[model samples]
Each structure stands twice: as structure tokens, then as C-alpha cells.
Target: MNPQFEELQKRMNHIGNLNNYLEDLLAKIPGNLLSGKQQAKLMDVLLDDSDLTSLLEGLKDPRPPRFVLVGRTGVGKSSLINAMSGRYLAEVSDVEIGTEEARRFTYESDGQVYFEVIDTRDIGESEAFTKDADAEAELAAVVKAFRPDAILFLQKATERAHSDIDVESAKKMMLSAGYGLPMVGIITHVDELNPSRIKDPADYPPGKLALMEDKKGQLRRIFKEQKVPVDAIIPVSSYIEWSQDPDDLSEVERGELTIGFDGRYGIEELLDFLEQSIDIRAAIHLGMTIRIHKISERIALRFIKVFSTLAATVALSPIIATDIAVLLSLQTVLLMIIAYLSGRDLAFKTARELLVSLGGIGATGFTLRMIAQQGSKFANLILPGAGSAISASIASGGTYAIGKAAVAYYLKGVPEEELNKVVKNARDEFDRGLE
Candidate 1:
């Protein structure tokens, strides 16, 4: 055989080995923990043979994910946007009527547009508006142009009295525009329902929680009664508490005015539901456009746990060559998933480059020393004559470090130089068992 052909065959074997290892690792994880369907999807994404650049380009397509906000006036549509985006993108007003013309709000981060929010005004507030053919026609025109991927129907939670105007308006919008998009019912002003006005949403009394559930049920029932299909009805308090700027106050009294400001609650749940309801492409677009660190952190942590378990399983037997290979593969796949969750476009080549920079899978002297040191540290933890438990500890610690580093790199946009430092710090922490 030609030398070049032999080398090519060797590389193919290596690739095949890695792919099989990853599949086995994924299978070891419980299906309930990571559903088989989700596992399969992740495998497909990680092992795809498609052009990496083309895949990334498609992920980063300029077309923003669009959402249409449909609600009556004074329902806190603007506030909802502000809470979800963590920016005052929409104008909150005390006036009963919102902007007359349909307005588009684009959310951009680091010069890249992520989402387009369309606020449809003058709908569902009055019976006359719903009855007016002209108003209906105008709404149809707006919906046609916006081409929204989802519909968010906002309703004030405190309002006990119900009306058919909202239902009628939704029917008209869905019918005239022929939008088959998923509809989500958002019950805003949930905090207002509590007479005592609790600042912490999680601290709500059992009765309060029950009331919230009941309200959500009511909203769902109303939509069902109107024959309008809704994906979910989430209750959220856009702004339960606010604090004054510390800088604006005197130095001595700076913290006085802002003593107990608990941020918005239920927003994360709403965002999660929205992300899951849409396809992966739209979810990625939304995540990139919206700066929701909490949601991203939650997802990244979950992936870290999943991958860490897989890594530990591979390390249990402690074959230097196989252990390092499996660990590296797990970490590489982990970083890729973290990047995706963070709404960052990471090509396969970039992931491979990162792995090489950290430490290539082919065992070098440096890599061997590091693995031995990690294994030695936890060797005592295993029972007498048992295989080294050091692998398990190192696996968990390294995975935790990788997760933190990935979060900083992809979500926080840390520079490459600084990101390396972050990775180093994480590794040190893991070695010390502090992670």
C-alpha cells in the first residue's frame, strides 16, 4: 500500500474509534436523565460529516427569529420584553393605550441581531376594535409583513374579570393572517395578585402559588374555549421590585434605598418554554439575540453534569491511553454543546483546534503526567484493591472546569488570551478538588 494511503487509513480508524467511544458514552447515561431522542440529536450534531463552515454559516444566518406580541393595552407587553431581554428594549407606559402603529424592536448583541419583536397595538382592547373590519385588515397586513415564528398573548394576572375581546382578537389574527405559529399565553403582573406584595416569587405562600396556578388554568381554559391552540400559559412577574441607583445616592446612604431588590421571577421558566417550543435553529437565534445569562447558565450546567458522568464512567478502568482519549472526546463534545447553548457558532474545526490547544488526545509526556497526577490523587478514595477512583474525581473536576471556561468564552465573550487564563484557573481548581 502507498504510504499516504496507509496514513489516511490510520486517520480514518482514529476517527472511527472516537465516534464509537462517544456513542457508548452517550448510551451509558440514563435515558430519563437525557432522553434517547435528545441523545440521538446530540450525536447527530456532534458526529455530522457536513461542511463545518457551511453548518456554522447556516446557524448564524442573518435572519432574526421573530415573535409577535398580541395583547390588550395595559397588559405589560413592553415590560415582558424588557424582562426577557434583560434590557429596556420596549417602552413601558402607564397610559392605557400603547403605540398605535405596529412597532418592531430588534435586539442586538455584539453587533449581531438575534431577535425581532413585533408589538401589535390596537388589538383586543375594545369590542369596537375587534368588530372594525379596518382594524382587522390592518392587523392582517402587519402579521403578513412580520412573519412571526411564535405568538405571545399577554394578559394581566390581577384582573379577575374576563372578557371575550382577547379571544376574538386572537382568532382574527390567526385566521386573517393564516399564521400557524405556536401561541403562548403570558399572564403578567403576577406579583400584583398578592395582597402583601411579596418580593421573592419563590417565597410566595402556598395559597399564592395555588392562585397563580388557578390563574394559568383560567387563561388556558379561555383559550381552549375559543378553540385557539396555545402551547403553554406561563405566569410571570415582569417587575416585582425595583431599587434606586446606588451611585445616585450619597456614599453613606448608597445602599439604603436599594436594600431588598429581588429581580424578576418566572422569566427564566418562560424563556425556557419558549426555547423548547421552537426548533433548535430558532432557539439558537433567540438565545444569541437575548442576553439571558440565567437560562444559559442553567443549560450549560445540565450539559456539564451529563458529560461529567460519561467521563467518569470511561475513567473507571484507568487505561492511560483509552482514558485520556475518552476524556478528551467527552470534553470536546461538551464544549461544542456549551457553545451551541450559549448561542455561539462553533465549527467542528474550531472545537478540534481548541482541544489541540488544551492537550491533544494522542498521549504526550505532559498529558501523561497530568493524568497520572489526577489519578494518583483519587486512588486512595477507592476501596482496597479496587480500580482507581481518582479518575472519577478528575473527570468531574475537569468537566466542571471546562463548563465554566466555556461559559466565559461563549456567553461572556472573554478574549482568547483571557479565556486561556480562565481555563487554567478552572483546571487548577479541579486538581485541588475545589470545583
Candidate 2:
């Protein structure tokens, strides 16, 4: 790692540790609120909410997507994985076997694996006899053991050799998965198919576009003939522009290969197709992994809802002071999570400063509505059940306000001074929402 990046990572860890310490202190000031039963309640609420159901399911499944890449040698699968990851990972491998694990590309973030490209051994070069069994048979056996999220059928538009075997292998893998698996036909090396001079797929002239269409048609017909189901066939150029580490701007400035493949094209379209076509679980994983612009806001909203619900249930405890303390702690954590999900590398101190200014964790104190909300806590002794309902409502509203304000700050670029107004507005809305 570069020194600068390593330093940034260290700072981030330190801030996270501080926030964790703060949360721990808050949890203890009033008492232990996160009992086993309360934790179960949070989980139940998260699972019950439809928006967060799939996200929670995906987060727990540590195993990344197994994308079975089926194609002959030189089909550009290795380059495609690098393009997707935006780095030099390695060559493709037969993902079934444990050998050559380093060569397999897995999309990871902060040490958590998000997605993996299980590139099958280059198959159908002419008919290959490999160790243990034929290429297709081995792939079938692997799929039988662990089903892939989807299959990527790769072929070069300019040179598609032994296309029949590509279709056959996908067929066998689909059968092995028991349930039919969605397959995407990828036409690689599209930059070479054109008038050659123009490399960007978006800028491809009618000639190149028509040629890609013909290739798609050919692959589609082959898969259809073999009775294999295919979701979409896309044309892409997987050539990475930089041969050197991109961080070294000087090296990249001198050694960059700026051409048709300078900026990879059609990858976004392919990912969008996968996110829209795959099962809910895989789609959530892909959306989170790539941070797809199309669905990122939805994912963020899911987390917001999760934290808000957690705040509500955790506030249901009979002790009013405990409920309030827990809500404050939960709201702080909610802000941290919202900032993170918004893809912002925020300094915890910056957030703390903003919260203090808004009277979130400072002597500036609560707004009128908040004072009333807090005043309702006294009802817990007199009203009991009704007081609990009011407490839960207050906690939920406060959490939602903090969550929306954090989203505005991190995602919408709302100015810090203006965030208080956003929080005020959200709180007002929640107040109005109460019957």
C-alpha cells in the first residue's frame, strides 16, 4: 500500500475505534440495553422489513458471487475481471479446484469479499483432455457442489472459434445447478472489430455496431439451439488503459495506453443487466458490491429504515432513561452507518462537530418538539403502555431525522449549516405524520 493510503487507513481505524468507544460508553451510562432478547428483536425487525430483507441476507452470506466464466482460451475473461475490479488481479482459473486461488479475481472492500469471478479453465480450444475429466464435465461437477450466481459466456466478436462448446458447457453447468441459471453472452474484444481506429464502444460507427449485433445474434442462436437460457448478450472491451499502477500519476502519464480501450465501455450495462435479471439475493449483493448508481440510494434507504426500526424497538424498554440513552447511542451509530453507506469517508470529528452544532450531542439542547418528546418519558410510570408507545415514537422520529440529515450531508452535499434545517424539516414531517 502507498504510504498516504496506509496513513488514511490508520486514521480511519482510529476514528472508528473512537466511535466504537463512544457507543460502548453510551450503552453503559444508563445500563446494558443490548440484551440477547433485544438483539433478537432487532434482527426480527430487520428481517421483517421488505426493503432490508435481502440486504441483511446478502450481508450475512460472506461468500461472494461465484460467476462461472465459460469460454475458450483468449476470450478476454481475465482482462474483463481486471476491468471490473479496476486493478490487476490475475488470470482466470477453474474456480472449482482449490489450485491457483491467487489467480482468481475477487472483488473485495475493506477486507470483505463482495464478488468473485470463477473463470473456468480455458475450454473448447479444440477439444481438450484435462486432469480427472473433460472441461465441461469438470465444470458440471463443480456447479453441482456449489452453484454459481450466474454464468458469463465470453466470446470475441472478431474471432469466435468453437462457439458450440461454449453453449454446451453452459448447458451442462445449468443442469448441474439443478435450477436453470441465468447466462450472459459477452462479446469481448469489440475494439478490434470496428474500423479499428475507433475503440470506444459508445462511439462505434454503424459498421462496428452492426458487426456486434451479428455476433450477438450468432451467439444467441447457438444458445437457443442448444436449449440454454440466456438473459442478455452484451459487447464489451476489457482492455485496461494503464499498464502501470494508476496511483503513480507520473508513471501513468508516461506509460498509459490511451486508445479505444482507454476507458472500459459496456461494463456498466452488463452489470445493470445482471442486477436487474438475477435473483433478489444476488442482485442486492451485486448492487452493494459495485455500488451501482442506479440502486445505491435504495440500498442506503434500506439501511436507514433498519437503524430506525432498531431504534424504535430498542426504546421499548420500560426504563425511560435507559430508552433515551439507547436512542442517543443508536442515532449516533445511524449517522455513522449512513455516512458510510453514502460512500463518504467522513471524519468522525467533523460529524461530531456538526452534531454538536445541531444540539445533537451538546449543551445547545433539544428543540421544542424534542423537549416535549422527552417530557413524555415521565408518562412511563403513570401511563405504562402508552408511555412506551410515545417513547418508541420519539426514538424512531429522532433516529429518522438524524438518518435523513446524515444522508443529506454525505450524499446530497447539503451544507452543514443547512443540515439542521433538514433535520428540523424531517422532524416536523414525522410529527405531522403522527395521528
Candidate 3:
């Protein structure tokens, strides 16, 4: 691995550790005091009705501002956060989905104005059996903890504007989480078009322009249909302008800030709206929530794996001796079934398959080897003799491999499309260099 990447990984680990400690401490805090009939009793003991009302209102006051970054898996949510904060607090990569949980990254400026960026995973892509429930629960949690002033629904402009599965999923999720909440649409990757042919929307060929308008219209209608009040639609491209150097500007000193991919034109407009519409305090609060959520989700996911492994080990121990074959077979079958069901979640699915394959081969070999050890009877049964234990051990190693991969996947927020693209690009680059 690159040294910089390795350093980043280490830092992320440290941050996660700190967040876990905080969560543990917070969990210990007591619940609210107002309960059932006690509410009336407390009110009676208050100095006066006005004073009691003020106290209750103060206690029930809403938390800080949190901006939820909702969109498809590989959209530039993390990149945008990094750019806005002017730092590398959130991890960024072409191959990874960095925000696995609802994390907060806060931006505090001067007095009371604050912005908190909240990052959440692609809840829409959750398992079919759990997607609705999971999404609903996730929405409820977000709404309850921090009543976000606005949600930034993101999508790739290069990708279809309408009929995009992620866009649809996002609209549904937002409504479920915060009914009638104000929202803004952000289209990413607009800088990807060929600049020489057509630099702006006006310059595009009539046919393509028409198509673009239709898409925008469709998207607008969808949101309107869903009753999600749209504030402003901003198209942005962050990394497309990475290749440019601002120091070499001409005498004209362009009005636009080019980030690459011709995104400066569109994103500048969006930034203007963000500055004007979103309260700075709310943005900072959302950013903090995003940072916190990232830390908690990562720690919680790791804990889940550790707990599950320990439970599986203990649960399987007693049955292994008496019914190793049956138990092993069942475990393998369950994993395979789960792997098949997890269509888009490649990391999880792959891990499940690895476990299934390992258990299957291990148990088969162990049984055969044991039977082989029985001399004539084993030979008659056609077993691998002393190789049974070795095979079983090797097979069990699959569990470890998958577990490690899953942990890394969640920690890094790597996505399937980005992984494939990187691999493909590397292959093409290698071929070119060889030539």
C-alpha cells in the first residue's frame, strides 16, 4: 500500500477508537425525567406555570444543525465534505464508499454559525428483507437526534438523472426520515463531458440539450410528485478540476473556480446557494454529526462481527463433536443463501461465500480423512486418511479471510463500481505502458 494511504488507515483507526470510547460513555447517561403521571407532579412543584413551561421547553429544545448527505453509493459526498471543510477529515477514494454510518464533521466559524455534515451509507441498497425497515429506522434515528434543516440529495450527472435507482431510493428515504423537510438536489460529475465540443449547457447540440432538459424535468417532477420541496439543484464536479493549477491564471483572472471536469461553472452556482440558503450554524452542526456518526458506525460494525464470531464459536463447539457434519453443512448452506441474496453488497456476499466454501470443503475432507484412519473400513469408504484435520483447518481459514475483508470494507467504505473501475483503469494503463 502507498505510505500516505497506510497513514490514513492508521488515523481512521485512531479516530474510530476515540469515538467508540465516547459512545460507551454516552450510553451510560440516564433517560429523560418526564414520565407518565410524574409530569403533572413535577409541574405542580414548579415555581409558576410560565417558569415550568420555560424549563420544559429548554429541556426539550432540539439539538444542533446536521446536513445529511444522501445519494447513491459512489457519489462525491465525501469529496464535497472534504472540499467544504478545507481538510481531509473524511476518507476519499475512487474505489471506496467512505461514509458507512451517519457521521458528523463540524465546521465552526467565529460566533454561533456552525455546520455539521452527516454522512450515511446507501441505505436504499440494503437487503430486500431489511431495506424498508432499516431505512425507516435509520430515518427515524436521524430525525429524532438532529432535525436537519435541509438534506442534500446527490446523484451523478453523467449517469441518468431520472430512472436512476439511487435517486428514487433517496427521495423515498428522505420522506420517510423527515416528512416535508426542505431539500436540495446536487448532481455530481457534470465536468465529465468533452469540453472542446461543448463547454456549457447552451453550447450542447440541440438533441443532447433536449435530452438533458427532459431528464431535469423528470427529476423535478419526481420530487414534486413525492412532495419533497426542492430548494435549488446544483451540479458539481470536485476531482475533475484536480489537474488544474490556479496560480497560472491569465490576465482576465476568470470569474469561475475550476476544479476540473468543467465543474466550476455549475458548482460555483451551487456553492452560492449553499452559502445563502443554509444557516452556517446548521451546516457546522451537521458536519460534527457526520464525523461522530462515521466513528460510531465503524466501531459498532466491528463489534458486531467480533460478537457474532464468539457466539458462533461457542454455539458450534458442543455440537461439532456429536454432529459436525450436520452443523457444518447447515452453516455452509446458510452462508451461500445469504451470499446469493446480497446482490449489490459484494463485500458481504463474497465473505459469506468464502465461509460457505471453506466449511464445505473442510468438513468433507475431515470426514474422509477420519474414515481413512479406520484402516480397512476407511479405505472401503474412500477417505483422504490423515488429511482430514488439515483440510478442516484450511477450510476454517475462509471464515477468517472473509471476516477480515468485511471489516476492511466497512472501515474504508469501498464500493463495488469504484473497485471495478480502478481495476479496469489499471489494466488499461499497464497495457499502454507495455506498448
Candidate 4:
């Protein structure tokens, strides 16, 4: 066999092993920690019999994940899309006559299609469009042709009002797309609500938070009243957190102030909702398409916590060898999961190789010595005649360091030589406990 083909076969076998390991590990995690549905989806990509090449090709699949934006003009549909995609892919217009036709906006990165958005004209621009038989038929025909996977019914939070025509238009779009399709109710322009503006979203003032929640509640009530079968109603602001100069007067002059970096709010939550609400394959496709580094980092950190906890628990083993064995296994599995979450096409063997390069289980004796030398600092936590607490501390800290190293290597694409330095620095910090 060709050497390249032989290497491919080896990689495939390694991936198979990794998949089986993940299935077993996820099975062991309590259902409360990870819902059965989420576990199943995580395992779905692995459980399939498809080859690595085919799975990757599927990522670049031409059938982009389609989303239909349903709302009247000035509801911030274009702004919302631009925010979610982290780029100026949509044409944002201030005029009330937004997107007269079914405009398809495709988001791609590195020359690969990730997802598509069908931006339709304002559903109910006037009484003539809403009540006229011909206009309604034309709108329905356009939506039917696009066949979106989901629909975003956008309403402005500052408007504080929902006309019957607005509700009816939303219902009409849902019906035209065929019932049971996932529809998410989005209240855009949320920053314009009371409190007027906020700089740090993470530290929202109590009044601001309350007002945001109130707006969400109001939208939900309207959706319920309108009989719109929406999966979720979330409030978002496209300009709350700008990625570029928030006060860039040039962009303001162009009437594109809302289109920038770091201006996104609740967009991550919106993405999370879509991931859980849509098909697993579609979710993966979207993740690849959008390439949202923040969301990827968030997922990586979450898995880090999960594995860090497991490592701490495993460290409680009475026998040193048993503790070392379990910690190594747990760390190995943790790295694999992180690699996957980071969207890296890494094989199990490659992950293990990377772990070994970071001193892995082979250097556990050295790790033990390092822990012992630093054990005095944690003596207060370690009970007399019991070393388990110290072991737990070392395991947790080391596992955390290992997780961070893996994220830097796989996700951040840090060079191997530089990454080795990062790992060494991390281990030293863990040994010293930030002292």
C-alpha cells in the first residue's frame, strides 16, 4: 500500500479508538452533569462508521445550514447576521425597505462554506403586502423555495409593542415553511432599552439586567399569545459589544456603526440554543462555518472543568500507582475531548503523542517528587496520616495545566517548541500553586 494511504489507515484506527473511549467515558459521567441528549450528540459524530475523509468532507458540504430571517424592516436582521458571523457579510440598511427579495448570504472561512442565511424582505411592510393575496403568495413562494432549517423572528426590544400584523406575519412565515420547523424568537436592538447603554455586559447593573429580563419575558408572552411555536425567545444587541473601535467616527459616518467586533451580546447564547435545538450534524456545520473563537474557547473551558473534577476524584485512590494510572487515563481522555471541541482534526494517536511530549504518565515519578516538594504548602488541607488531599490537589492542578497546554497547542495552534515551554511553565506554576 502507498505510504500516505498507510498513514491514513493508521490515523483512522486511532480515531476509532478515540471514539470508543469517548463513548465509554461519557457513559460513566452522571446524566445530571451532561444531559443524555447532549452526550448522544457528542457521540453521534464518533459512532458513525464513516471514514475520517468522508467526515471532513461533510464539514465542507455544499448544503450550507440555512436560516430564514423573518421580521419587518429595521428589526436588525442584517445586523444580527453580521454579529453572529463576526463579519460584515450582510448589507445593513437603515431604510425601512429592507431586502426586497429573498437574498441569500453565505458565510465562509478559508474558502469553505459554513452556513447560509436567506434574508427576506420585511414580512409585513404595509397593509397592502399583508392583506393583498398576490403579495402574500409571492412571499410564501419565496420562503418555500429556500427551505430553511430554522427561522429567526426578529422584533425590536425598544419598540415595546407587537402589532397584530407583526404577529400574523410571523405566523404566516412559520406556516408557509411547514409546521414543526425550529423557530427562534429574537428581540434585537436590546441595548436601546432602559439604562440606554452598557459597556461591560459581563457586569450588567442590576437595573439593566432586570430590564433585559423584562424585555425577554414580554417577547415570550407575545409569542405565546400569537401562538407562534418558537423553540426559544432570546434578546440580543448587535452593537452592545463592538469588536472594532466602538466609537469609530468613520464607521458611524457610513451608517455602519453597528457592524464591528466585540459589539455582540447574547449571540453566544443564541448559538448555544441553535446547537441544542438543531440536528447534531447541522450544529457541527454551523460551528465550523462561523468559526467563533469565543464559543470554541468556552466549550474547551467547560470540558476542562469536567475533567479537572474527575482527576481530583481519581487522585483519592490509596495506592500511588492506582492514582497515577487513573489520572493518566483521565488526562488522556480529557485531551481528546478538548481536541474535538477545539475543532481540530486530530487523531487519538496524535493526541496521545502530544500528551507524551508534555511529559505524560511516563514522568509521573518526577511529578510525584514535584508534588512532594510542594506538599508542605498544602499541609493544612492534608489530614494527619492521610495523603489523599494532597494527591487530589496535585491531580487537579496538574490536570488543569495539562488542559490549558492542550488548548494552546490544538486550538490556538501554538508551535510545538513554544508549546513545550508553555507546558513546562504551566507545570511549574501548578507545583508552586501560583506562589
- The better-scoring model by TM-score among 1 and 4 is 4
Whole-model lDDT per candidate: 0.61, 0.63, 0.43, 0.62
For every candidate structure, what is the RMSD over all alpha carbons to the true structure, in angstroms?
14.5, 8.6, 25.2, 12.1
The residue-level lDDT of candidate 3 at 152 comes to 85
What is the clash count of model 1? Answer: 0
* lDDT-sorted candidate list, best first: 2, 4, 1, 3
lDDT of 4 by residue, 3-74 (tens): 532343343334335555566565555544355544453444234424433333333332457787877778
Model 2, 320-349: lDDT tens digits are 454554455556555665565555544545
Clashing pairs in model 1? none
As for candidate 2, its clashing pairs are 199-260
Superior candidate under TM-score, 2 versus 4: 2
- Model 2 poorest ten-residue lDDT run: 251-260
Error of 4 at 257 (Å): 11
Steric overlap count per candidate: 0, 1, 40, 9
Decide which is better by TM-score, 1 or 3.
Answer: 1
Write candidate 3's Cα lDDT for 1-435 as tens digits: 235323433433332342342233223222241232332322232223342233223222313455777776777876665354433332312222232444555543222223555655545555451355654565557544565666788776666633345556556546655455557787665545444345554455656445445546766777777666678776555543433444565322321333444323355455445533544333223323333333323333333333223323322222123223322332332233222222222333344344433322342332342232222222323543333333333223322333333333344454633433333343244336436
Tens digit of per-residue lDDT, candidate 1, span 2-76: 353233223223323435645645554444445554455455544453332222333434245677777767888
